[model samples]
Target chain A: MSPLAAFGTALTALRVNALRSFLAMLGVIIGVAAVITTVSISQGAKRAIEEQISSLGANALMIRPNSSSRGGRRGGFGSGTPFSDADTIALRDLPYLAGASGTIGASGTLVVDGINWPSDVEGVDADYFDIRDIIIEDGRAFTQAETEARARVVLLGKTVERELFPYGGAIGSSVRINNIPFDVIGLIASSGQSSGGRDRDDIVYAPVSTVRSRLSGFRYPGVRDPVNAIWVEVRQGYDVETVTAQLTDFMTAQRNLRIGQEADFVVSNFADFIRARNESEKMFSVMLAAVAGVCLLVGGIGIMNIMLVSVTERTREIGLRLAVGARPRDIRNQFLVEAIVLCLAGGLFGLAFGAAGAYGVEKIGEFAVSIEPMVALIAVGASSLVGIIFGFYPAHRASQLNPIDALRYE
Target chain B: MGALIQARDLRRTYRMGGMDVHALSGVTLDIEAGAYVAVMGASGSGKSTFMNMLGALDQPSSGQLIINDIALHERSADELAAFRNQTIGFVFQQFNLLARTTALDNVGLPLLYSGMATKERHARAAHCLEMVGLGDRMDHHPSQLSGGQQQRVAIARALANNPRILLADEPTGALDSRTTQDVMAIFDQLNREGITLIIVTHEDEVGAHARRQIIFRDGHVLEDRR
Candidate 1:
């Protein structure tokens, strides 16, 4: 028989037992859906982290003080006083250094009229906004002169803006932070949420000099204007690791620390950290897809089982066909086509369900999810492969049945 | 002209629990084209085995079988299948129509296996159904039809390829006497239309309807009469 006619016969046979056919396809449906959904979610998360990393600043290194060993007792991370505003200014002239900024932050309550909201108040240098890629939605970033003069000007993050200025006009308004009034110079644009699920637009920014002199009283008598951390942006076309190694050497000599000594500062590349995270996420996604592939294998076996049952059930029909001059090849083709149709149909349904599932995760779960067209194609291809692989044995068995014995079968 | 079917020393053996069961032991026969013949025998007399061999559904262990000028015994299984498709039609006592399919589709089934296109296959099936007086019942499934109508649909299916020979094994065994007569009348009409007809049955009344009768005893032809 022609393949087209055999296909038609397969379709008719499946339609006769529609419920059983659907039941046979259910495993494939779930398998493909799981694959698509899990891959989409993981890919979305990886992309989100990539975006966050890029937004933070490419070729940027963050230097923070590590635990200080005092009297042979080690403190937690960022416990030393190794970094200050002077160190940040000294690093500005280093090779491949695009920009440098020092920042100090503390939790404080902001009051506008009678309303109040608790948020992190960060003090940054004039170059902090440019180095961090922070966009200004209103007004302008604090100028160099403003920072030198210790101007009490502030920038509210998007989330802080909503909380402080519900009726608009927050750019020129006066808001008191920890009972000290400061001029609202600008509003920072929304940066959305971080991959870690933290709200990125919920803090406030002010000049470092202003925060040190007024809010956080001077601490160290020897060093000038101690700061919490230093952010350094590398110039374009410069390798961050080379620049980082140079900066570490510079800091070590400036602090009079030797190689054997436990240095009080730690310098890290932000991109490396995030890329490591992204790689792990990708590996996790692959593992999940592998699990889904196992499910597909199970589904293929289910189809094989059903095809076997169908071959047994239709022994008389097969016998009749053989008696009417159908070649064994024709019978085999018919059943094989039936199995492929079942799997392909299931795969299509699975694609639809997976797309819907990804959408649901994005909407209801508030997670990033994106489906690739190639994933859909691969899913379909895999299901077809499954059909061909699992359907072969049963179809061969059906073709091998003796016509006389089959016809005489009860 | 030469005979349409010729068998020489046809033998079929089976191994049953370590013993040889000779289903067809050296039987020989010749049947001319357009002849209506009945192969009558008691059970285990090898009449059904002979019928299976004549229909090309089974191969003889040792013999030569030529049907419609093609040597069936030497044909491969696939070639035998094509031979059966092109040169023979079969009707069974159970009226083995595909259960959920319409009478027209059941009739068109053989044509489908012959790789005939849909439009032509349907047209030929409709013509065969008309010949069987079942043209109006084309859309009816087997369960929706009476026993006689089902058998008629089976006959229409057998005629779908317009085979030169028709083989009916106990065609009226499952029907009432009235329905049996109706079916026999159709067979007589088909035989009169110049198609070779072979019926294998134990009933004397059914055998009497054929133009020639061959009775088998102990895997051998005991009588052949015209």
Candidate 2:
């Protein structure tokens, strides 16, 4: 028999037992739904993390002072000798460097119109905004002259602006940080939340010179113009790894550390960090999809059970067909088509259910869930495969029946 | 004319509880084209086995069985299936019509294996149903039809492929005597049209309608007469 004719027969049989067919497909439906929902949500989270990493500057690198051990007592990172202004100047002059900024952070309460709010005040150079991709939504960024002359100018993050100046006009406003007056020069654009669940817009920016000399009072022993960390941006077309290696070598040489002596600094690339995070997330998603795949397999087994039952129940019909000239292949094709059609139908419904489930998750849990087209296609393909894999045995059994004995079946 | 069916010492044996049970042993017969033959026997008389062999549904052990010039033992199972489709029509005592399907579709089932188009299959099925006096009940399902009508539908299905041989195993066993006569009349009409017919039954009344009768006893043909 033609495959189309066999398919028609299968469709007719399924329609005759519509409720049973649907019940048989329920396992596949739930299985595909679980797989699609889990994969899409994880992919969405991965995409969100990538965006966060890119916002921090795709080519940016963080150079921090490494923790030191004194008498077997290891202090935390940044507890050792911090980067000096000379070290920042030396790294800034590298040929492949786009720009570099030194930052010194201090937690202080800012009083604005009798509203006091606790926030981090970051000391930064004029190049900090460019390195961090922090665009000004209103007012201008800090000028080089302001950084050099230690002017009391500050950039307010969106969160700080909202808290301190809820009624707009945050630009040109005067706010006291540690009782020192500073002019708000710009409003930093919001960058949403970081992957670590920290608010990215809760801090304020000011000139590093003004912060170090007046507000923070931080000066590492034997270090001139002590800074907590240095933000480095690689020039376009220059490999980040190459620039990172150059900077590390330059820093180590300038520190005058002997051979086998651990350097007191570390250079970390944001891109590498993002890649590592993506890899872990992908592994997690694959594990989740594997669990969901087991559910689909269970569902496929359900289909096989039903198909076997159907073949047994229709033995007399099969015998009649055989006597009427149906080839064994015809009987086999009919049952196989029935199974595949069931799975395909279940997959379609599962796609819809999975999409709905993803949306529901996003709404209830406030998590990202993206339904990529490729994921849907893969899911449907997998379900069809499941049908074929599980549907073969029963179809083969039905095809191998002896016509005489089958007809004699009561 | 050459014999339509030629069997030489046909034998069929089965193993039941590790013992040989001969369903058909050393049976030989010849049936000509357009002949109406009745195969009669009591239960366990090997009549059904002989009928199954003649229908190409089973192969006889250690015997040469030929039908329409094709040796049954030499053919593969799949080849036999195709051979059956092209040469034979079968009607069982239970009618064996597919449930929940319309009489027309059930009748057209054999044509599906022939790769016939839907329109042609329907047309042939309709013509066969008309021939069986069931043309008006084409859309009715088996459950909706009476036992006699269901049997008629089964007969129509058997004729869908225009097979040369019609094989019926106790076709009227489940019907009332009035309906039995009705079914026999249809068979008699089909036989008059020069189609070879073989009917297996235990009832003498059913066998009396055939032009020739062969009786089996204990796995051998005890008598054959016109």
Candidate 3:
């Protein structure tokens, strides 16, 4: 029979058993939906990470003191001898360095107009804003003169601004940090949430010199200029790995570490962290897709089972067609077409279901989930393939039936 | 007219539990065009096997069978299918109309394999249904039709490809006496139109309606008369 006519016949047969057909298609529907949903969510997470990494300054690097060993119990990172201000100056002088700044932070309470709020107090040099890509929303960043003169000027993060001056005039206001009064020179723009799930805008920024000499009133024993960490930004088109290697070598030599001694510092690149996160996320997506594939396989098996049952149930009908001069191939085509139609229909429904599922996840779970058009297309294609692969055996069995026996079947 | 069907020493054997069962043994016959032949036999007499060979639904085990000048043994299965589609029409005891389908579609089924366009297929199917006196009931499904009407729809389907022969296996077996007569009358009218008719029946009254009768016993023909 003509392919179109066979397809029509198949459709009629399926329509006659609408409930069974839908039951057979259910597996495929759920399988495709799961695949799309998982891929969308993973992709959304990857994108979010990428945005966070860029916000953290794509070319920025954090240099922390290595762990310190005392009585064989090693302290965590940044527990070794802190870097000196001379080290920051030396790193800033590197030809490939775009900017560098030193930082020290401690948790403290800020009070303005008797409204006290607990927040992190971070001390940084003038170049910290440029190195971290921090945009000032209200007032200007700390000037070089302010940093050199140890001015008690500070920058308020969005969260601190909102908490201290809810009515909006926080810039140029005097806020006391740990009972030390400082002028809020600028309001930092909001940067959403950090990858660690911490609020990014819940800290305060002040000059590192003032924080070390005035606020703390303490210094590392025998150390002239000590700082907790150094933030560095590399110039465009510069290799961060090469710059990191140079910085490591320079720091090791400057610290007088012997060849057998381990360096007392670590240079961590934000890009490397982003790459690692993406790799893990990709692995997670692949695992989810594999699970979805198993679902599709089960769905395909269900289709095959139903098709076999249908073939057996309609043996007499098949025999009648054969008696009326239908070729074996025609019979095969009819059943195969029925299977593909079921799967394709299921796939279309699954696309809608998956989109709804992704949207639901984003809304309810508050997670990222983006459904790309290509993913939907691939899902449909995969479902069609599943149909053909699983539908063939039953259709072949139907085609090979002896007409005499089939007609004689009760 | 030339012989429309010729069988030379046809035999059919079946293997059941590893023992050979001879269904058709050494049967030879020639049927001319426009002939109305009734095949009659008791149970296990091989009448059905002979009919299957004549309709190209089964191959003879050890003989030659030709229909419409084409040697059946020389054709491939697919070619035989095509030959059957173009050359023979079949009607069964149970009517065999596809349920839930309109009479028009049931009748058009054979034409679907004929590579006919949809419009032409429907037109020819409608014409055959009209010929079988089911023109007004073309839109009715099999469940909505009576026993006799369903039989007529099957006959229309058998006639859709305008084949050279109509093969009916107990065409009136499922009908009442009045309906049997009505179906037989349609067959008689079709025979008058110069289409060959082959009917298989055990009922003497049903066999009597044909112009020729062949009787089988012990897998061999016992009587042949016209």
DockQ of each: 0.71, 0.65, 0.59
Stronger candidate by DockQ (1 vs 2): 1
lDDT of each residue in B14-113, candidate 2, tens digit only: 9999999999989988999999999998989999899988888887887999899989989987788887788999898999988999999999998998
lDDT of 1 by residue, B1-226 (tens): 4699999999999999999999888888899999999999999999988988888877889989999889987888789889878899999889888989999999999999898999999999999999989989999999999999999999999998989999999998899999999999999999999999999999999999998999988888999999
Model 1 CAPRI rating: medium
Chain A: TM-score in each model: 0.86, 0.83, 0.82
Worst 10-residue stretch by lDDT in candidate 2 chain A? Answer: A83-92
What are the Cα lDDT values of the candidates? 0.90, 0.90, 0.89
Better of 1 and 2 by TM-score: 1
Q: Tell me the spans in candidate 2 whose CA falls farther than 4 Å from its real position.
A: A64-87, A94-98, A104-123, A133-193, A196-228, A234-283
Clashing pairs in 1: none
True contacts kept of 3: 0.61
TM-score of 3: 0.84
User: Which candidate has the highest TM-score of all?
Assistant: 1
Model 3 segments more than 4 A misplaced = A65-85, A95-98, A104-193, A196-228, A234-246, A252-266, A277-281
**Superior candidate under DockQ, 1 versus 3:** 1
How well is each residue in A209-305 modelled by candidate 3, as lDDT tens digits?
Answer: 8888877653777667788999999888899899888888888887889976888889999788888879988999999999999989998999999
Deviation from truth (RMSD, Å), model 2: 4.6
